[model samples]
Target: MVALDGPSGTGKTTVARKLADRLSAGYLDTGAMYRMVTLAVLRAGIDPADAAAVAGLADGVDLEIGTSPQRPGFRLGGEDVSAEIRGPEVTKAVSPVSAVPHVRELLVARQRRIIAEVLGEVGGIVVEGRDIGTVVVPDSPLKVFLTASADVRAARRSSQDTAAGRQSTVADARESVERRDRLDSSRTASPLRAAEDAVPVDTSELSIDQVIVALCELASHRGLLAGCSAEAAR
Candidate 1:
């Protein structure tokens, strides 16, 4: 298994998907799972800061996540919410909702189950999130903690938002990213941090393709790319 953990705007989503594709493995975006719960909290009109209320809502929410690297899906109560979870409303509220301890407990259990299932079926899986290496899959064969400069991450986030039809400025994106970093790193439950054994890759000056190549090399070095061809693994 491969655990890709990092803060927002570091290209975790894109790199995880592409790396999974290259390795012919399943992919799980654990962040999207949290976003699904955050959306449910918003839809119920519950305050995200109200930990008890949000945890109660999360306990009963039916979340279904797809593991396909090519087309992973997020469903909330049988409705496809893949795109909706990426909106600004969810983005703004997700940090608080995800910080709740019970919510993390619930999702971490589900994530472990999904990871086991995918590993059994596909022989490998790439899981990405804020705490995957440190909390979700501590024994993963390969763990990567991706990082980038705040300015570069903010610019990437702005471009991503604009491309997705969301209006955002670099300044706004920087504030949002930094806010999330503070909240995620300071959260009491399974905080955002790199595991001691995780490989750190600074992506401030590297392209997405370069990051993927570096991870692929790491996986290969760890003997995790058993079936992949030499060219694809590198």
Candidate 2:
């Protein structure tokens, strides 16, 4: 399996999706898993800090990522939650909930199972999240740890938040990005960092296409490219 780990606004989701499409491999968005769980915790009126309650809440919910030839989407308990999970409300609260050990354990277990399923069916998967490479699937053959300068990532976040109408000014989105960066990098449970075996890429000055090209090349080098007919490679 392939594991791409990185923090928010670093383009982990987009890059993983594109790489999966290119290789004809299944994709899993683990961040969506965390966001869905956080939404559940919030909707249930349970504090994220309550580890037992969060773990219990996770038990009663079924979280899985849906995949196809085009890309992957989020499904929580058989409901398509792709759109709802990306709202400003969920984004604002996901980090704290995601940092909790119970929440991470729940999501990581689900993530590993999904990866295993995809691997059994298709030989591998492209799974992206903060802890995918290091903690979720440490033995993955292809491990990528994506990164970008803080300012560039902040700009990306500002653009996304602006398009979503979550912020009026780029500055506001940048601030949100900074705050999230701190929380993600400092969290105790599977904090965002490169795994010892990861291939690090600084995308601060690179285009989306460039980043995907690098990841695709790296995957090919590692013999993780799927659906690569010999004649086609020739």
Candidate 3:
């Protein structure tokens, strides 16, 4: 397993997918699990602040995750709301809802199963999120802590979340990312943190491709990608 933990940007999602492609491994979008739980609680008409209700909602709902593009499943209460869970409202509130102990336990178990299934095959998985390296898969073969300045991360967030070429104001994006950073770090359960042995990759001054090259080199040097295929020559 390759645990790619990072803040909002730093290209963790894109880089993890590309790394998985190069190594012929699977990719786990762990953030989506949190979003799924948030969406479920909201749709169930349960107040997110009520921990017991949320826990019951979590138990009652089923989260099925598949990586296939056409039918990526994040079903809740027998309804598929994969796309809805990724929208702006859930995006902003997920951290708070996910911070709850019961919710994190539920989602973390699911995440472990997701990674375990991929491990059953010869191909490993590249798991990406805020806490993957520190908590979700602490024993992953290769752990990377990707980071960049908050300004850079917020700029990237604005670009991706906006429609067309327009974006939320830079300040708006910065505040959003900062709030998430604070909440992620302050949370009691599986907080976002770099694992003790993780290699920190600061991408504030690096291009996406440059970061990819660096990670690929690290992977090879660590022998994680020694016999891998599906890569294009650098």
Candidate 4:
């Protein structure tokens, strides 16, 4: 198993998906699970700050998460909400909603179950989120913490938002990223942090392919690329 942990705007989701595809492994965007709950909370008109209420709501939410890197899907109560969970509304509320102790406990259990199932079925899986390495899968064979400069991360976020049809500015993106960083890093339950054994990768000057190649090399060295093709392991 591989654990990719990083804050928003660090390209964790894209990198994790691509890496899983290259390695022929399953992928899990644990953040999307939290976002799904956040969307559910918002749709119910519940305050995100109300941890008790959010936990109660999350308890009964029927969330189905797909592990396919090529076609990940998130369904809430039989409603496909993959795109809705990425919108600004859920992005803004997800941190607080996920911060709830019960919510984290619930989702972490589900995440572990999914990981175990995927590992049994596929023999490998790449899981990405704010706390994957530190909380979700600390014993993963490989753990990577991706990082980039603030300005670069903000620009990347702005470009992504614009590409997704959301009106965004660099300034606004920077503020949102910074705010999320603060909230995630300061959360008492399973805070955003790198595991002690995690490898740190600074992506400020590396393209996506370069980052993937670097991770592939790390995996190869760690014996995690046993069945991967030579081209992919290169």
Instruction: State, as a TM-score between 0 and 1, how close model 2 is to the true structure.
Output: 0.89
User: How would you encode candidate 4's per-residue C-alpha lDDT over 1-234 as one tens digit per residue?
Assistant: 889998888889888999999988999999999999999999999999999899899989999999999998999999999889999999899889989999999999999999999999998999999888888888888999999999999999999999999999999999999999999999999989889999999999998888888888889889887645365545
**lDDT score, residue 178, model 1?**
98
Stretches of candidate 3 above 4 Å error?
68-73, 77-80, 164-167, 227-233
lDDT of 1: 0.92
Checking candidate 2 for backbone clashes, the offending pairs are: none
Ranking by lDDT: 1, 4, 3, 2
Better of 1 and 3 by lDDT: 1
Count of backbone clashes for each model?
0, 0, 0, 0
For 1-234, candidate 1 gives per-residue lDDT tens digits of 899999999999999999899888999999999999999999999999999999998989999999999999899999999999999999999999999999999999999999999999998899999999888889887889999999999999999999999999999999999999999999999989999999999999988777777887788788878644465535
lDDT (tens digit, per residue) of candidate 3 on 1-234: 788998887888777777777776777788887788888778777777787888777776667676532334666657777668767778787887888898888778888987888878646888888888778888877899999998999888888777534458778889988998898899898888889999999999988777777787778778877744224345
Model 1, C-alpha of 8: deviation from truth (Å): 0.4
Worst 10 residues of 2 by lDDT: 225-234
TM-scores of the models, in the order given: 0.97, 0.89, 0.90, 0.97
Sliding window of 10 residues with minimal summed lDDT for model 1:
225-234
Query: Against the true structure, what is every candidate's RMSD?
Result: 1.3, 2.8, 2.5, 1.2
lDDT agreement with native, every candidate = 0.92, 0.79, 0.79, 0.92
